[model samples]
Target: MKIIIGSLNPTKVGAVKKVFNQYKVEGLNVPSNVSNQPLTDQETMQGAINRAYNARIAGESEIGIGLEGGVIIENDRLFLCNWGALVYENEVILASGAKILLPSEFINELRNGTELSVLMEQYTNEKDIRSKEGAVGVFTNGRITRTEIFEHICELLFGQYEFKKRKEENN
Candidate 1:
């Protein structure tokens, strides 16, 4: 199947391609000029949906995927969260992360409208928003990059394919 990923982040593209390659899914990167304006959990998912929908309208691919992330506050705590969406032949699959906690100060900063990327930049001093190597980098460590966060979200949305394959083998 021809799948288009809606983002220009290299880490996200690479991670999605790595997993999709195992299933023999031909993946293509479709960069979106859309704004990265995700301030809340709902808005984050909206960003992904917008990207995926835009990609589908812009291409002939059989599938389009979008990944978006943001920080959300709950129970007096700040959490790093993500959402993913898949659009294919009129079907849409969406999924999100289970809240991951952040530092108290970071939490306060985020609630003030500071984007996660900027927070990461000031905390890590790396100045690269896609590396996931700064403050939040600890979550991914060396196992995955920041860009992979979106890829991971996509995996959560599409991972059922692997589960189905496993079930078929047992049958």
Candidate 2:
């Protein structure tokens, strides 16, 4: 099986490779067609779906994966959100990772129009933080790296596909 990922970011690409070890996987830059910082779950999921389909079309592969990280405010508290999508032909499956409340300091910066990636880089003083451990890694203190987070979501997405396939076969 051939799999294509929407973003060339190491974190995302690494997650796909780790999850679909049996498949040939490649990552390419693809547009999400969403805000730099998606503030809602709907926008975040749409971004993932968009990237999945676009990457499938671009790579001409059997499966395409898209991972998107965003933030949402609930009860005036900001939470880190990550979503993943898998695209096969006209079908799509999605799964989201655990959400954690972000620090108030980071929320202030996010409210000030700074993207999460930019805020993370500034907070960590590391260039290309997204390519490495990402905000998930920082918040979890490396307990759960970004690649692992996305890999879990990818597994969930693929599991859903497998369940659907089995159901269809039984029917």
lDDT tens readout by residue for model 2, 16-123: 888888889999999999988988888899999989998999999999888999999777788888999999967899999999888767776777789999988888
TM-score of 2: 0.94
TM-scores, all candidates, are 0.74, 0.94
Q: By summed lDDT, which 10 consecutive residues of candidate 1 come out lowest?
A: 24-33
- Tens digits of lDDT, candidate 1, 1-171: 676777666655665687576543333455433345354688777877776777666656767777766666777777777777777666677888555677667766665667677877776666766544423455556554455565567677677645655786999
Q: Give the lDDT of residue 77 in candidate 1.
A: 78
Model 2 stretches with alpha carbons more than 4 Å out: none
Best by lDDT: 2
Q: Rate the local accuracy (lDDT) of all candidates.
A: 0.65, 0.89
What is the number of residue pairs that collide in model 1? 0
Which candidate's TM-score is highest?
Answer: 2
RMSD of 2: 1.3
